[model samples]
Target: MVHGGEEALMRQYAIGDEIGRGRFGTVRRCISNATGEALALKTTPKAPLRDPLDLALAEQEPKLHLLASSPPCSPHLVALHAAFDDADAVHLVVDLCAGGDLFTLLSARGGRLPEREAAGLAAQLASALAACHRRGVAHRDVKPDNLLFDAATGALKLADFGSAEWFGDGRRMSGLVGTPYYVAPEVVAGREYGEKVDVWSAGVVLYVMLSGTVPFYGATVPEIFEAVLRGNLRFPPRAFAGVSPEAKDLMRRMLCKDVSRRLSAEQVLRHPWIASCGSDAVAG
Candidate 1:
C-alpha cells in the first residue's frame, strides 16, 4: 500500500497548513515542487489504530481509492493522486478542493438548495456513487462532509473513502460503519446489504438539499435509528412547496424501505430529477 516511494513524498511536495480533519486523518494543503500546483495531503497517524479491524480499514483506503478511480473514473470523485507511508503515518495525496465541503455550504445557505441546483449536485453525487458501485465498492459514508467543491471550477467533488468497502462479485457487506444521519436502515439493523445502501444515504442527501431537513428525525442517536427503521417520510408543505413532484418521486424511490425495491445508483441517474440537469443526465 505504501507504493514504495515513502521518502520521495517530502521531496516532491511541501506540506502546508491544515485544511481539514476527520476520524482517521488531517487533510492539509500541499504544493507540488515541480508543477507549483496545490493539492491535498491526508495524514493518518499510525499510532492510535490499535484494533486490527481499524488497521485493516485504514490500509484499505488506498486500495479502495485505487479501485474506484480506475479508468472511466467519474469526474465527480476527488482524484487520489498518490499514497505512501512514512515512519509515523500513512499519507494520501489528493485533489485540493479549496472551496470547502457541502456541509459548510449548506450551513451558510440556510440548509437548503434551490431545486435546479440541488438537481445538478444530486446528479453529480449519483454519478460518483454509481462509479463506485461499478468498481465493486461502497461509499458507506455518503454524507455532506464528504462532498467538496473546487472554488475556481465551482464543481462538487466527492471525497473521504475511509469508510468505503469492496463488495465485488455481488458479495454482501455487513458493518456498523457510516454516520447516523446518512446511514441506511439495513445497515442500522446490522443486516447484510449491498451497494444500494449508498443510494439510501444519497436519498437522505437529496432530501436534505430539497427540504432543509433530514428525512429521519430524532433528538438523539437511538431516536434517529428508530426513525430510520420506521422509514416514514414527511415532506412538510413549507419545506417542499417549491419542489416538483418528479423530484419527490425520485426521493421516494431512493428512500424506499424495501432494499429490493430501492433504486440502484444507475437507476437513480435515470430518474427524472437527475434528468432535469438537461445534459447527460441519462448518460451511460
Candidate 2:
C-alpha cells in the first residue's frame, strides 16, 4: 500500500516494499500503472542536504547516472528509466534487477565462482568500465555489492553512481572513499589518483569471485588500511588451484600496487584471458 497522501502523487506507480537503503535514501519496488512493468524507485530526502558536501553528492548522483545511461547505452549498465522530484525528495526509477546483487549471489554459491564463469562476468564489467572511462567518467566504487543482474537475461549490470566523478585528460582526483576491501593503494595512501583506481577495484572483484576470499583482509579498519597500503597480494595455492594461469596474470596486472603499472580498462578487455574466452563468455 502507498503511504498516506502519496497515492495522488504516485498515481502512476504502485509502490511496493522497500528493496534497498543507503545513506541518502531508500529504494522501493514499484509497478507502472499503465503497463504494469516492474521498476526500482530510489527516493532521496531533500531535507538531508543541510551540509554543503551532502548537497553536492545529492546533485551529482543523478547527473552521473544520466550520463552513463545516455545515448549509445552500454548493455552492462543499469538503465535509468525516468526521474522526477517532489517537494520533499528526488526519485529515480530504474530497471528492476530481479536477480539481486553479486555479493548475495556469491555468498549463496559458497563464496566463489568457477574461473570460466568469473571470467565472463569480469569481461562484461570491464567493458562497462571502458565505456564509462571513454566518456570521462570514473566509477570510483566498483565492488560486488554494486553489481546487479537481470533475472530474465542473466546479464550483469553495474549499478550505483553515488561515488562516480567526471575527469578530464591528465586530471587526478583526491579522496578517501570507496569500500575498504576494493580501494586502491593510492586511495588508501590519500594520494591523487585517476581512473586506474576503478581497474584496481575491478581486479579485487575478480579475485574475490575466483577465490572466495579477499586479496587484502584484516580484523579492524586500521589493520585493513595497513594491509592495503602494504600491498601484499597473495593467491593461496588451495584457493587458486583450479584457476587458470591466464586469469591470474590478468589479476596481477590489474591489482598492481604501483598505479603506473596497472592495466587500463581497455587493456583489461584485451588481455589474453578475456580474448581467449570469446564473446560467449560474456553471454548473460
Candidate 3:
C-alpha cells in the first residue's frame, strides 16, 4: 500500500491470479495502476487467532524481506516495498516474478531437471544464499516451492522468507522449525544451529534437482528424522550421470551431519562445481 501503517492505501491495483497461500496469508500478483509495475500483494488476516510463535514470526517476516531487498543482489529476492496493517488484514507489496516457482517447473518437466540447467540454477541460488548469509539473514526454508525461477532470463531466486531469522550477536537457534523433509539433522535433533542449516537444506534441494527425489524418505516424521540423523543419502553413481565429482563433493560437504563442519554459503559459491558454471553465467 502507498500509505503508512494501521490503514490500507487508497490506491487501486488490478489483482491477478492467486500465486500462493499459507497459514497466515495468501499472495496474489497485482498490477499497480499508479506505477504500472507488477507487484505481489500478500494479505494476512488480522482477526483470526493463531499460535503466539506464528504471530511473532508473521509480524517479523515483512521487515526481514525489506532488509534483504534494500541493497539488492543477483538471484533476485522478492522485494518488499510497503506494508500496512488494518483491522481486516496486513497487506504487503512486493516485487513480482512472473515465471512462477521451481516446483511448478519440476512438475511440468516430469520431476528431475537436467544437470547443466540444475547447476546453473544452483549457482544462482548459491549466490543469493551467500548474500543472505553475509547479511546474517538465515533463510530457514529452502525447498523447491520456495525457489522462484524467471523463465525469461533463466534466473533462479529464493523467495518466501517467512521462516527466516536474523542473526544478531551471532546467536544460534534451537527449535524444530521448517518443513520436516527439508529440515537439517541438527535442527531435527533439537540441537542449537545457525545458518549452516540452510546449506543442508540446499544440499537436499540439489539432490532433488538432479534425481527427482529427496535424499531421505520415510512414511512419517520420526522415520524421516531417523533417516536424516543417520545421514544415509542414496545417490547411486548411475543416478546423476555425468555430474562432476566436484559437485558431489560440494553437496556432501553441505549435507554433513555436523552443523559446525558444514560449508558456508560463500565457500559453496567458490566450489569447483559452482565455479564451473562461469562468472558471466553465475550471479554475482
Candidate 4:
C-alpha cells in the first residue's frame, strides 16, 4: 500500500498494547479493522523539536524504510506497510514479527548459538544487507536487537531503518552514529565512511551470535571507543573452540580495520561461511 494519510491510519487500525519503546516513540501491536491482520504501529510524538538533528533523524527513518521496502530489495527486510502523521504523533504501520528479536533468542539460548544456527542467521542478514546496499541504502545499525523472526516460519527479517541513510552516489557519510560496540573503527575515529561500516557492524553481530560476546569491550564508552580504534580482532580459545576456521576468516574480512579491505555486503554473502548455510537458509 502507498502512503495512507492520517485519516486512513486512524480509521483502519485498532491500536492495542505497547510492544516496545525507543527514544522518539513507542511501538504497539495493532489489528487492521478492514482485514483483521496484525501489524506493528510505531508512533512518534510530534512534540516541539528540541534538537533539530533529532527531528531530522525522526523524519528520515520512515523515508528510509519506505525506500528499502521498494522493489529490487530483498523481502527478508521488514516491510513498511504504511505511514501517516496526526495531530500528536506520526504512525508507521509495519510487519509484526511475533517470534521476537534475535537478542531475546540469543539470551534464551544460553547467550550463544551453535555455529550452524549462527551461520544460518548470518546468511540471512548478509543477504539482507546486500539487498540494502544494492538499493543504495546503508543500514548503519545492524545489531542483534534489530533482527526479528517470523513466528510461524522462523524466518529472519532485518528491522529498524532509523539509523539508515542513502549513499547512492558512493559518497561517505560523517557522524558518530551507531551502537558503540558495533561501530566501525573508521566511524569511531570520526573519519568519513560509507556502507562498509554496515559490514563491520554485521561482523560484530556474527561474532556475538557465534560466541556471545562483543569483540571490543571496556568499562566505559571512551574505553570502548579506544578498543575499536585499536582494531584488535580475536576469537578467544574458550569461546571459539568449536567455531570453524572459515567462519573466523570471514569475520576477519568483514571486520578489517581498513575500509578498502573490508568485505562488501555482497562479498560477505558469498564468503564460504555464509555460502555454506545453503540457498534455503533464509526466506526471501
Model number with the top lDDT: 1
After superposing candidate 3 on the true structure, give the runs of residues whose Cα lies further than 4 Å from its correct spot.
Answer: 1-7, 10-14, 46-49
Regarding TM-score, does 2 or 3 come out ahead?
3
- Pairs of colliding residues, candidate 2: none
Candidate 3 residue lDDT tens string, 1-284: 23555333435567788988876679888888788887888877766636766666667777777677666554556667777765567677877777878888988998878777777777777777887877888889888888886657767779887788887588887777788788999888888889888899989988888878888888998998888888986578767777667767888998898767788888887888777753345654
Where model 1 places Cα greater than 4 Å from the true spot, the runs are 278-284
Task: List, residue by residue over 1-284, the lDDT tens digit for candidate 1.
Answer: 35545577888899899989898779999999889999999988878888776777777898899789756778788878889866678788889999988889899999999888888888888888989998998999999999998878777788988888999987999978899989999999999999999999999999998888999999999999999999998899998998899898999999999999999988988886687652352233
Whole-model alpha-carbon lDDT for candidate 4? 0.85
Give candidate 4 regions above 4 Å deviation. 1-8
C-alpha lDDT of all candidate models, in order: 0.87, 0.85, 0.77, 0.85
Shift in Å, residue 211, candidate 3:
0.8
Displacement of the residue 229 alpha carbon in candidate 4, Å: 1.0
Write out the backbone clash pairs for model 3.
none
Global CA lDDT computed for model 3: 0.77
Clashes of each: 0, 0, 0, 0
Superposition error at 270 for model 2 (Å):
0.6
